[model samples]
Target: MRTLRKYAGPLSDRRFRLLWAGQGVSTAGDAAMLVALSLALVSSTGSASALGFVLAATAVPRLLLTLVGGVWADRLPRQKVMLAADAVNLVAQVGIGVELLGTVDVGLVAVYAAASGAAAAFFVPASGAIVPSTVAPEHLARANALVALTRQIAMVAGPALATALVVTIGAPWVFFLNAGTFAVSAVTLALLRVPAVAAVRTGFWDELRQGWREFSGRRWFWTNATAHICWNLGRSAYQVLGPLVAVRQLGGELSWGLIAQGAAIGAVGGAVVALHVRPRRPLVVANLALALGAVPLVLLAVAAAPVVIALAAGVMHAGLSVMQVIWQTTVQNHVPEHALSRVLAYDWLGSLALAPLGLALAGPLADRIGLPATLAGAAVLLAGGCLLVLAVPEVRRIGSRPHQDLPTAEE
Candidate 1:
């Protein structure tokens, strides 16, 4: 009880609490948008290929602009960036919602999605870099855990709300709700009061180069990211192809959402556990958890029992969330705050570079090799990628060091 009390006080910080609330709302909105968008694509075209293009449009921006976003994150005030980005997002969502009311043009939706996604590309790195500024070093794990929990809750609520809206009101309203969420988030963010770190006077390109230097110079940074590129590629295959498999091969959207929900539930628990227990070798723990995700992919492909597949998926998601919390903490701790955004941008670029390729190829690959065979192949690839990291000495041996350069907080 004493230990628990000692560890549990991070959530009481006022700045973090406001940030957390805003982020929670934004996450829910994003989730709702995802649900509405997916349903819109499926209902309008009834083609997996169409959905793939939409997904690609939404994602490819991050792969392209992540570095630029990072460069700016290093040079500018993170809080201001967040505030401006959310305001931009609010307008974009409203415009899209209004457009959707007139036509079912998927292309128009794609264009709006691309614009919003480009804005999102900048938002992520800045948000990630700013988080450490709001809390003490000892409280990082708890902070990250709270963030993950909010994300999970938002995801669960968002999809459910989207479903109800789609049934009751329509798809256009979902976008309106998304706009409202960003409005609320932006207002809350504007209310936050923290001492601003002055922006450094660095040219964009030079700052970008410096961020790259920091990213590539570290063995642990590149090694883990490289492994994650492979992992995310496979995971992307699941994201794009999984629903198609469920809808066409299994049942329909409801079944697919259920499968996703199972994973989300597991992830919530995983985040909590990660917050409570700080692993020595966070990379090792993260890699092991990532490897475990392959179990469900293989199980779903081979096993005919639906319950078995669902159980495997739940375990996979739970493990993945644990891996994410550890990964976030390690990156934030080791990277300098001034350059953290750009480094994170590089991290996002490297990790997600192949996601579009995976999405593009999954359908065709499944067509040629068969769904079960393709899933089995993905499982093999996921395991192989994880094993590659284990072979690297830095990753295998790396552990959490004490906050030697930073001060610890009192509870």
Candidate 2:
């Protein structure tokens, strides 16, 4: 019998190891940037509204142009596209940092945010599609889990480190550090030697249409994507309302922070488990695991104690981590490699369809209907949407057995 490889097995390939290290540093910087930017804006302006504006500016452009980015990634070398995106991101970070140190204007910050978002629109799709080319199909799941493990660690450590940095050196320096990490990422991309995929010559709109057809044809693909739409909508709702519940019912900011830490821990733990075990019905089990995501929201609605709420959040996040690893592996395994970036763009667009609405409506709707009622509705949507997806025959039947993805071979 062949001995199964651990998560570290993917790192045995020199090219993938370089890419993985760069990604880890960049992701950690990103996590820290989130805290640093939010804190810098809020502290300077002394308004919660500034925070929202900055975030919205980033998210909207990223959402709107994601498909176009997909087209470019498919037509060009994905690694080159990533390098260019990283360069843009580095510039944006420097711009924000300079603006923050000088005037602290929200408008200038919004501009920088928009630039960063545009860069991300291209970077994300390229990154997603590049993985299969980096490692064999057999190691895809392990690669994904290891990446998530790095991100989870960053999610936990980044904010705390940023908090300390902000207190001592200042926020602009954090931005500078973030920019530096992107440079590191770009350098690694330059060194990577993955064979170039044959450029598809179809026109942009036609290419996009072709990608859409591919994304829509797979029943398992569309079902899971739809499930993501519902899950993200509800998850966003909980994010908007959960803090309020924390402040009013639970111990407050500190408790909420602790709860978030618990979720991070669960994320890492879940990735570890996923690294070891290959589920037969990956999507079926992923959807089922996603159902656990609703648990914390339900608990929060009931005015559960801090400890209980934290535990629930941990459970919820573990489920999320499991689903993420399997879902990414499934896509890399099944999708045609040449078209993967465009298909991934569609996946991104679909997954985030209702997210903004969820975030925007949560506070107003909760105030009108009450927190408990709003949370209850969110919980219902979360569970109901997951179950609905699981009912699809393709989603239930797709097995997790390893197979070669077209063009995923050394290219």
Candidate 3:
């Protein structure tokens, strides 16, 4: 009962509960939409290159606009920014569904992807920034855990549901469902009674420069961000290649769905573990756990069976979930509330800057070096990058407890 109450504590806040519920639904839909989009492209063109192009199209715009989004998120009401992002996403999803229902026009799909990605630029920073305002300081970690838990659960359900729907009805309806979920999220954002941010008004370029300073000043933060860039770049190999491997070696969409589901299940476990454990050296523990992410990539390299690959994916995702929870909690606790969104925006930018490049290159690389070698290389890059981040003294020394004074960027 104590454990149950501790995990459920965040839900006691009406505002947080609303936010959680809405995000949960929307995340599930997002997961389903990803599966549907990937499969639709693959089925239509039978080319990993095509899928990668569309995915890169989605990522490039987000990468370009994220810093601007972050600056605005801090300047404006976070919830309002989130609502506008949701609205853009809703429209984009509807357009994608309508287009897919008529014909599989890759160009049209890419356009929609760009629109959704642009909206996500604004949404990500605001969403991260808003959490601090929704719950008490003490409940911050637990709240992050709960939010992650719901997202993992959605990931678990979304792929399975998408696979079934894609096999039966079609991928178009999945997009429609995602649109509905965005509407639900918009409504929840509308209802939230969040405290207004008291930001110091400044020039846009100056504000962006300030965010950069905040992000760059922290040795631990930028070090981790560098590793994240490498991590995302390496992980893109799996995202781009996994579906193709499943189609050729394993059964098809079902196998890929199972692997995705396994990862989500593992992430769920990780989130649960995070709800209970507060390691004294949070980043150290997080970096170590993140090393597990390499396992599934290696498994895929060797052409492991679907069930085996799924289990490996589960292990990897569990570590990712733990790392994510720790990272988010630490940032929220330490960063100034007014500057949080901008700092997080820099984090997003640094982390995902190379992801599109990776996605764009994955198919061609696999075509040249072959899938197994590419997977193994990605596995090495991810594991090595994660472990290397631990060499930073600040990442090792930072305590789990909240600090009244923010640490200087330098050691």
Candidate 4:
């Protein structure tokens, strides 16, 4: 009874329902973009480094501007920020679509990717806060679960669909279709009636300093944030390397889609598991769960076979999904509502700090050394990163109860 009710309660809320449905459509488009972009780069250049360049172009801007996004999300109406981000993304997508349809300029595609990344930095921080703003605190865990579920379902369908379209009609139309989804997302946010919560109009730097204090002041917080940084570096490497190998050795876009779809199927199961079981030491479990991510990267490097690699991806993503839920719920419940977006921004900044560097380096290094060796090193670093985070006593002991206000921001 409790299990069913917990899942159904958030969906019953009209506002959450609208946000949930709209986000589902948007996520599918994102998944499709992932497939289309990778295939487009590989098909055009046949160079792994070219693919990495585009990925790096996207990550660099996000890393640079994410803090500014954090400040705005905390100060202004979050839904409005999201709407603006969506509008920016919508225009960027159209640019990419037009460029793809006419003359394929790799440099031009990369520029658009950077623009989209800047918009995403703002979208992500605002999006992170909206759930806590809209849903009851008690139901936040379940609400995140539903969000994960929708995203996972899209992951299952979108890649397969993308590969089919890319194989037949080509990448430009797939990109144009993605532009339409952004329109859907913009419409939903325009209608969203977020409860108006007053924000402090602190000087911009002070807000960042305060958020930094709130974030770095907590030992568990900083430790987990560091862990995320390491994990992202390794994960970005895998994302760039994985698709190239799939297209070259495994069997092209269809195989890439299969591996992605398998991960999505597994992620759905993990999300369902998260909806029911709230771990007492969520940070500890999440850290251990992250260690599982190393497996698929190792599999891809060693096997390079579709069936085997897809199965490994499934196991890896199941753990990834659960860890994501636990981490989000922990942060949302712990941070002060007024400063939540800024703190979340710091968390994002800290976690993704090295991703651009990793994405930039992964291809060039792999070309020089060897793909298998590069992947194996990443897997080793990924596991080592997880264990180091687990070594922190604070992360291991993080309790289920909320810690809304830390004892001291300076401590």
Candidate 5:
């Protein structure tokens, strides 16, 4: 209990409090949308392959624009950029909600999906860049833990709320709620009293180069991120393959939802553990947990027992959440605050670049290799990729030392 208290640092800091509240609300709303979207698509298409396309659409734009967003984040004030991102999301959500008020077209839904995804590409980089500014270095792990807690709470609450909305109100209302959440977040950010951004005047090409230099120069940064690329590749496969398998081969959408919920609950526990328990080799811990995330895939594919599959998947998501908290803290501590967004953007691109490819191929691969076999293959790939991380010496032995003295912007 004392250890857990360490992770709940005083959010009484005005900046952190405002930011946390805004993010918590926005994330919960986003979760509602996620659940609503899943049901909406399932109702419309009745095919997991089509659902995969929606996920791919969301990821591909992030892959393409992530670096650009990062550059923008570095060049401009992160708070303002976040404000704009939130506004953009608000508009996108409103548009979707309004459109859905009339009819439920798959084409329109896909368009809304792409637009929302593009908005997210901007939002995520900005959020990542801004966090280090909001809290002190010593408090970063706690902040990350708090954010993870917010995310988990959102996950648990969002779906059930979405389910209720869909059953009683409708999917469009979920979008409306999401839009309102973003609006509230934007307003809260506008009220923050942060210091002016440090002027780093550089040309577009030069800024890109500088950002790239910062990103690639850190050995630990690139290696850990590279490992994540493989991890996400396998993850993308699991995202598409797992639910589909549960529905078509095993049970139905309800069963798949249960499986997903189980993972979410386990992830909440993982976040709690990561926050209080500081490992010496934090990066290595994160990498290994993420890589071993593939273990669930083996159970999912090979096992006929539903209980076994659910338990394995729950364990996998638990590890995933812990890795996320560790990685966020590492980035916040290691990278300069001014260039954090650029680095984060590159991080996003590197980690998720293969997601579209994975999603794009999963359907066809499942058809050819059989769903169980393809899932088993993804598990094998994940395990091998995790083991491959041992080759990166920095990953194995880094994050055990103190942070470098980098010039950080004030929040």
Candidate 6:
């Protein structure tokens, strides 16, 4: 019973509950939107290039504006920034749905994608920064775990739901449904009574520079961020090559799907574990856990059986899920409240910056060398990078406590 309460403790806070519920729905909606968009594009244009262009359209604005968005999130009320983002997404999804209902216009879809991406740039940092305001300090880890669980669940179920809905009610309605989910999120944000955070108004560029300084000053943070970049790069190998290998060697799409399901289930389980465990040296533990991500890459490279690869994938993602929860909680606890969003924005940018490059290069690298060799190299790099981050004393020294005496950018 105590264990149950520990897992459920975050929900006791009304604000956290609202935030969690809204994000849960919103995340699932976003996942569904991805499927609906792809189907709509393929059905209309029959051009993979168009699909890729529209997808890139979303990423370009996000990459360009993420830092600016982070600064704004710090300057403004995080909740308000989120609300505005929700509104923008609602409009964009609606536009996409309406257009799909008529004729799928690639240009308009790209425009909507850009708008949504820009909104996400603002929304993500605010969302991460706002969590500390919603839940108690003691419950922060569990809260993060809960949020991670929601995302994992959504990743698994959302696509299935979208696929079903697309077949039944059509892609337009799926977009419309996604719009409604955003509305739900907006209403929740509107209702939230977040504790006021004192805004530090400064020159936008100055604030961005300050954020960079804060991010770079923390040895633990930057080292971990660097590791995360390498981690993402390595993981992209499996993402790009996994399906191809599965089809060629294993059994086809079904095997790939099972592997994905294994990861999702592992992620869910990892979040559950995170809710209960509080490691003293969070970064140390997180790095150790994240090293497990390389297992699947190694297994895939060796031409392991589907079940074996799936199990390795499960272990890998479970570790990732735990690492995510610990990383978020540690950042929230250590970073000063005023600069948290900006710092988080830097983290977000650094973590994702190399992923596209990795995705692009993975296929070429595999072609040049061999699939097994490329996968093995990525696995080694992923595991080695994670373990190497542990050599930073700060990473090993940081504790689970909130508000550690860490230096700020101003210092």
Candidate 2: C-alpha lDDT: 0.87
Q: What ranges in model 1 sit over 4 Å off?
A: 1-8, 40-56, 104-108, 240-258, 367-372, 402-411
lDDT string for model 6 (1-411, tens) is 987886899999999999999999999999888987888798888998889999999998898889989999999889999999999999999999999888677898999999999999999999999999999999998999999999988988888998999999999999889999999999999999988888777798888888888898898898899999999999999999999899998889999988998988898888878877799999999999999999999989988999999998999999999999999999999988889999999988976677999999999999999999999999998999999999988889899999884564356
Q: Higher TM-score: candidate 1 or 5?
A: 1
Clash-forming residue pairs, model 2: none
The worst-scoring run of ten residues by lDDT in candidate 4 lies at 402-411
**How should the candidates be ordered by TM-score, best one leading?**
6, 2, 1, 5, 3, 4
Best model per lDDT:
6
Tens digits of per-residue lDDT, candidate 1, 1-411, equal: 877756566667878887888989988989998888788678767887777777778777766887877777777777777888888788878876886687567777677777787788888998887778788878877888889878977876788899999889988899899999998889878887766666676677778887888887777778788878877777766776678777776677776777777787887777777777688878888889888888877766764455566677788888888888888888888766777898889988876777668877887998999888888888878877877888877676666663322211110
Which of the predicted structures, 2 or 3, would earn the higher TM-score when compared with the native? 2
Note each model's CA RMSD in angstroms: 4.4, 3.4, 3.3, 3.7, 4.0, 1.3
Residue-level lDDT tens digits of model 2 in 176-256: 999999999999999998978887777988999888888887877877888888888889878999889889988789888
What's the lDDT for all of these models? 0.78, 0.87, 0.89, 0.84, 0.78, 0.91
lDDT tens digits, residue span 1-411, model 3: 987887788888999988998888889999999999989889877889989988888988999999999999999999999999999999999998998877678888899999999999999999998997899888988999999888888877788899999999998889998999999999999999999988998899999998888888888888888888878888899899998899888899999989988877888999888787688888898888888888888988888999999998888888889989999998887778888999999988877877778988999999999999999999989999889989888888887777543477553
Residues 1-411 of candidate 5 have per-residue lDDT tens digits of 765555667374678888889999999999999888788777756877767777667666767787788888787887788889888889878877886677566666667677777777777888876776777667777787888888998988888899999889988888999999999899889987666667486887788778888878877777677777777777777899888877777777777777777788788888877777578888778867776588778867864556666677778888888889888887877777778788888888876767668878888998998988888888877767667776777666666333652332221
> Which prediction has more favorable lDDT, 2 or 3?
3
- Weakest 10 consecutive residues of candidate 3 by summed lDDT: 402-411
Q: In model 3, which residue pairs have backbone atoms overlapping below 3 Å? A: 217-409
Q: Is candidate 3 or candidate 6 better by TM-score?
A: 6
In model 5, what is the error at residue 297, expressed in angstroms? 1.7
Local lDDT at 95 for model 2:
92
Local lDDT at 213 for model 5:
81
The parts of candidate 3 lying over 4 Å away from their true place are 38-54, 101-109, 166-171, 237-261, 297-310, 360-377
Clashing pairs counted in every model:
1, 0, 1, 0, 0, 0
All candidates' TM-scores?
0.88, 0.94, 0.87, 0.84, 0.88, 0.98
